[model samples]
Target: MLQSFMNVFTTLGDTVVVPIVIFIVALCLRVKARTALMSGLLVGVGLTGFGWIINAFTPVVTKIVRQMVSTTGINLPVVDTGWQTSALVSFHSTVGITFFIVGLILEIVLFLIGYTKVFFATNLWMNWGFMIWGTLAYFVTKNFWLSLGLSIFMMLYVLLTAEVQADRYSSYYKINNGTVGAAHNMENVVPAIILDPLWNLLHFDRVHLTPDALKEKLGILGEPTFIGGVLGIIIGILGNIRRLGTLDAWGQILGFGVKLAAVMTIFPLVAHLFGQAFKPLTDEITERYSKGDTKGLSEEENIKSKKRWFLAVDDGLGYGEPATIISGTILIPIVILLAFILPGNKTLPVVDLVSIPFMVESIIAVTHGNILKTIANAIVWFSLGLYMCSYIAPIYTHAVAQYGVALPAGAVLIASFNVMCRPLNGLIFLAWISGNPLWIGLTIIVYAAFQVFLRTRRQQIWMYLKKMSDRNIAPTSNSNMASEIKKQMIKS
Candidate 1:
């Protein structure tokens, strides 16, 4: 779309607009004149400089990397090596990705905007758990050097933003619950996990606990009571900055920018540093398993065992891993079958249509809960609404007929049912993660459906559960209890 505009403008006009808009927004919203101007200037300079430096330097970096690889007889899984690739990766990783990620996270704060602490207290933990897990996973795969840079940048950012947020929230009569605040929970677990590898490596293993261990040890923040208190204070402070009147908005925003820049600069460095840490972590972790460290093992062994579970679940379910598995196992073969058996030019794969929701849930499940989760979930519903809102049975039937496939319309419908229901499952998950009524409603729907399925097959799900090994009965039972309570009320 922008490409078309570039041709129409016959100049670099598109590039010209963002900075100008950013500056103007900063200037207008800023309470203080001096801070506004400075913020405006910084935004303009920083963004422009970033674009230019990336354009000029990316090629050099790529060439140097490529040459280094060739000389050392190394082969890196680089997507086509060119200036464009380098620039794209740089822009995406540093600016685009960071802004989007932070923006998504920031949206959660908006949920707190006119609400009291008591109302959002539970929601906050859910949000934290999701962020922690997502951030930890991101860091694990992300460059350690990049994370180091991000950590230093984030530490400062957290501190500064904490002050600003505290001040902002305070303006609205929000009280800081001192340094000690909420404990880490499942909501932010994903972010914590995403940030874990990078943070662990950056701090020289200060948070030695694996992402899973951390989650189990520190369900929400994965830190001590002191750390949670400190974090809450920081967030409280950042939230409070809005209380300082409009004049401070510019400074607060500027501070945030500095923090973001620090992240941009440092993440690449962190990525470079911990590029190989994943290997050693894997090795040490695997060695423990081979040593037969089961539950109730020695501390190190138990720790390793816990780490393994966290790593497995986080990685497997994180990053749409579950959906990928499902698609590979179920969708792909369906698509292939249709392609080969169907008569006419292959119509859209039925599996393709159905797979969309599974993928959506996978992504949403991993994203830190906040306004982002709400917005993303809304989008998912919109998509499902489009598909199921109408009797699109003909669409499915026609597609199937066009192909010579023998799959019945009923089978296609079932497949569609599976996919459509998947998104609703996401809603239950959302409620569960949020620890709210939303989860309860969705759980009812899921349990009802499960009961219907059980009546037909009678024993598949139970049989499947029974076949599993190395289980955590208490937690599993609790989850099942939640499901059963939901089931009894709305049995299908």
Candidate 2:
């Protein structure tokens, strides 16, 4: 009886079932069937496109790098095809780290100086180091030390360049007023859109005064080390004054640590238990099938046996009903409640939890009009979902690893769960999902420097969109609510 029920539940969660559920939900929400179908089709096409792009670009980058190595005698290692080229991959090195730090500091300094003009400039630098470094690193070297060193150099170059630009005056701002801007914004579409059109864009007049300006403004501060120390001391002093230097913070920290441990330790154990409990169901069928006990059962029994096999496997995942409810209803509510009761006025954790899913849903909800737009947004959402998985899954896996729990062979696990999800989410959001090659790609290289220094998603998104809009990169769409409804009705 238990085996039969487990089988039924497993069947309900299949690949086919999930899409059906998505379709049903979309329909119930008044998302037209055609719109949903198109969106689904687009997701498939985008994934296919992604694969082809990777297959094509990997070789091209490899060929170019090899030639460059041959000519320049850089002695860089050959590219490793095995490593993923996600934002997280880019962030895991010394250079990537340094680049982000410098960009972040510069952003704060510029903000202090009331220089909102630097937002685009900063994003470009940070994005370059992070966005380009990862994909380029794969082609350049395999050694961790070499990669780290090079990444740092790249970050340094970007920082110095920003320093130069910050001190200089602009003759003209990049004009992103309409559809023309949208084409330029498309990553690598034309490759040479003259992002700045000579005199107006170059700030040649400002170049002469940049050194003098840098000296007058930032030279007094001197080296980065001094600035870091000053900031640390300020934080330390504030901590001491507030009496939040130790035990007060420790409890929350420890509680999160415990929660992480539960995810890491408890989840897999439950999975294992479910597996063992259902083993008999599998073994009996396997035994009968292998031994050819055909006379014992009818055609319906045979169908039931296959169905049982599917269910037994699915139900053993252990994250079925309990985890779903915990995540969707209970866990989220508890997190919010805790945020309310446990301390600070800042809803950092709650906001982070809410933001990522919210962003994904919002993007999808907005794209419910056109076919390609809907599909593109869905692919983006899927990509975002993977990022969320990367974020939370690691925390649980790391917790287990820290406690020295040995996982089953071939089981992928996370190393640490960042309970402070908002900042981390913002980092992942900017560096990975938002600027994915499919979304913005190398344009990010132009925009990333602006992004690395900021800590908040709200601020980061605001800065990023403003930069795009100011530069006339974000294309303006002309759809309103009534039009959207009419379009949906036409599609259905």
Candidate 3:
């Protein structure tokens, strides 16, 4: 009965279900019923529109990656089953159906104890990411408690990171109450901690290739539209270089370029509509609870405001930003090339390659849209994941194969870069299944220490992000909204 219900829930997908949840949350927050209803519909529309833009280009990009691989005569053993396979395998398990409940309880408990300021009960579907590791851990040990513990730990890790990074996301992406809560996105805090100092020491933080920065220096030529078109042309050339002399090839190239250009132009407008969807609920929460001049808060309201709670929403909110798009798209071909050249990497990174934009939003947001740093961070992360996905492909294959999923012809094993999620997650899983008490203890200690750092050093983390991010400039496209954001960011 639980499995049957789970199937129906997963089948409904995000666009259909998330908006309904949003509406209910809005009403619970005491927002107007009419406004809540409209907000819900707008969110659904925005998600659908994002789906349309992504779906339109995905097949094309996937084909290009496959073609590039074929032309280069590269062979990788593990098939890239993408996140659909990963999520389905995850949700099919005993661990999956209950992870949402566990994660929510944990989130609420942490918030109540003042250990985390992130309220992530919204967008619970994203919690499926935890079960990827949970599913894999279960397959290895067949131990339910251990599997559940891994999932809970992954959730706890992200909740803490999300709280620490909330100020940066709001200040940089101008999403107000929204902070990236996607496990794939928040897990990036791992790399940022390890390598961010290197980026600073090398002075990579000084160069800004974000769209707004470009516009300031080069005028209209630096506009996102122009940048998108140029990036499209580069991708076109990469995909069609061998056929450059043919007329049809030029047509395909230019047409592909124009398609990307269209996505670049249309995505922000779509994103703005999505952000507007949350305005009513966010405004109500802020006005009702904020201890600031907006309202004289009761004790409860003051505690709520002082906690500085942020909504852990989808990364899709910032996925449309120019730097986010560019950083992910540019890595498409590089992913293929690296797959061939990187030692011990057996996964070809097919379907997930097209979904790179979703994976990089948090990194881009934290860097304040520093395209160079974002790409640099992504390349390192993806390279490591290639090895991780390859190492775990057999177990992942075994985990999902029980479902009797239709395999692409001649495929034996499969994995997803996203299932690797991040190096820290991969390391945690490795230690758990290693059967080494020392490794397990070390992993626990490291994770516990990191969580403590996020909890205690949040202000220091925010200061570092502020130093890395641009200031005294518009964070959002709307000048008035940007001014308000600037004021809030300053006061904070």
| Residue-by-residue lDDT tens digits, candidate 3, 295-386 | 55542333234546677666777777887887887888888788889988788788888778888877776777877788788788888888
Residue-wise C-alpha lDDT for candidate 1, range 1-492, written one tens digit per residue: 433433443243323443344334334433244443443344344334444544443343233223322333322111121112112222223322343235333533532352111122211112221222222223233443333222222222222222212211211111111110111112122232243244334442332222233445666553223232333233223433435466554454344334423423432333222222222332333355345445345423332232222111111111122222222222222332332343332122222322232233222222211112323233333334323312333332333233232443323321232222223323332343343455445555655564355335323422332221112112434667899999998986
65 Cα displacement, candidate 1 (Å) = 1.0
RMSD of each: 25.4, 29.6, 5.7
Model 1 lowest lDDT segment of ten: 176-185
Better of 2 and 3 by TM-score: 3
Q: Write the per-residue lDDT of candidate 2 for residues 137-172, one digit (tens) a residue.
A: 433344344334334434333332322222111101
Give lDDT per model, in order.
Answer: 0.30, 0.31, 0.76
Candidate 3 local distance difference test against the native: 0.76
Backbone clashes under 3 angstroms, per model: 86, 27, 0
TM-score per candidate:
0.23, 0.22, 0.89
TM-score of 3: 0.89
- After superposition, candidate 1 runs with Cα above 4 Å error: 1-15, 27-35, 72-492
Q: How does residue 474 of candidate 3 score in lDDT?
A: 40
Candidate with more favorable, higher lDDT: 1 or 2: 2
Judging by lDDT against the true structure, name the best candidate.
Answer: 3
